[model samples]
Target: MFSFRNFNIADWFSLYRIMAVPLLVAFIWFGERQLFTWFLLISYSTDAIDGYLARKLKITSARGSQLDSIGDQITLVMGLIGLWFFENEFVLANYQLILLAFLPYVLQMIIAFRKYGKATAFHTYLAKSSAVLQGVFILWLLFFGPVYWLFYFMVIVGVLETIEEITLIFMYKEWVEDVKGIYWALKDKRRLKKKSVKNPTS
Candidate 1:
């Protein structure tokens, strides 16, 4: 599923994030804060670019979705670790609030993995919003400092996005991608039952 030989340009972008992990960690180990933040920003930017290119070029696929989701998680985890390393004071102060958002995100991943043997790639609108806010918050904190309002907002959206993800996980028996939200899921034929051929019931 992750074969580089068959990967499209968008998939290659996702692969780039995965490939950059060691370099990113090396920056941290070397105490290169400026370099790490700039590189992290580039990682986040690749996320947006890959997603856009996938949609625009119609190269979206199950493999691509899975790769993209993995890349996003890896990048986000790296961002948070960068936050902890460079901004230890802020993390120490807000560990409770951060977990309030993070724990449920972990739970959602657990639910998806248990059911599908992998993480979801719903890529819902709420998920996109949360990702953007999270990327912005992490970058802003690393570049300047934490903003209280943004932190609170990111937490709220993160929790809400988790709830929506859990619901969607239940709604679809099979792994799926690019779900917009619960509303669309309700009308999704994928979630509906097959009609009786003879009865033809609605």
Candidate 2:
């Protein structure tokens, strides 16, 4: 029911990425606890497949890019939220700790969107590795339940991943370009807003 009606072959992977949403939701919401574990694995698998197929088929479109970003956010962010809730329900950790780790990543997403007009392209190897590590850490925490030591381990890993991203962003010089683009766009936007305020008709 979900597949786009036009393609016989290329659409299969796109369909998979779309399908992962409800599957993930169902797993987290109503499925057996053990089954929810599969959700993470499947969602990530589809992430890989969709990316590969999009590049291999040369069918990358703006819509596809947006869809992929939304899908990823839904899975990763929502899953983390779910884990945070689970932690609360079980008295696993202070809910505040989850917020502390989560907020930075949320800010990163917002900054990337504002600056680059897209989520960091998935093409960077270290970025992908960082994502995978983050996902694994979250899943492990979910499955094993939280431990104080595990929390420390995750913090260390998370810091390392952040460092990797910072290094990679600078290594490519795309960071400067991203910042410059956003700076110019915002400056122009603000100037236009000011002019509009001064002259109502023009």
Q: Which candidate is the best by TM-score?
A: 1
Model 2 lDDT per residue over 52-140, tens place: 88778887654555556556666777567566555557435455665555666666666666656656543344345555666776677
lDDT of each: 0.91, 0.56
lDDT of 1 by residue, 1-202 (tens): 5567899999989989988899999999998999999999999999999999999999999899989999999999999999889999999999999999999999999999999999999999999999999999999999999899999999999999999999999877778888999999888774444322323753
Q: Which residue window of length 10 is worst by lDDT in model 1? A: 190-199
Return model 1's CA RMSD, one decimal: 2.9
**Model 1 misplaced regions, further than 4 Å:** 194-202
**What RMSD value applies to candidate 2?**
8.4
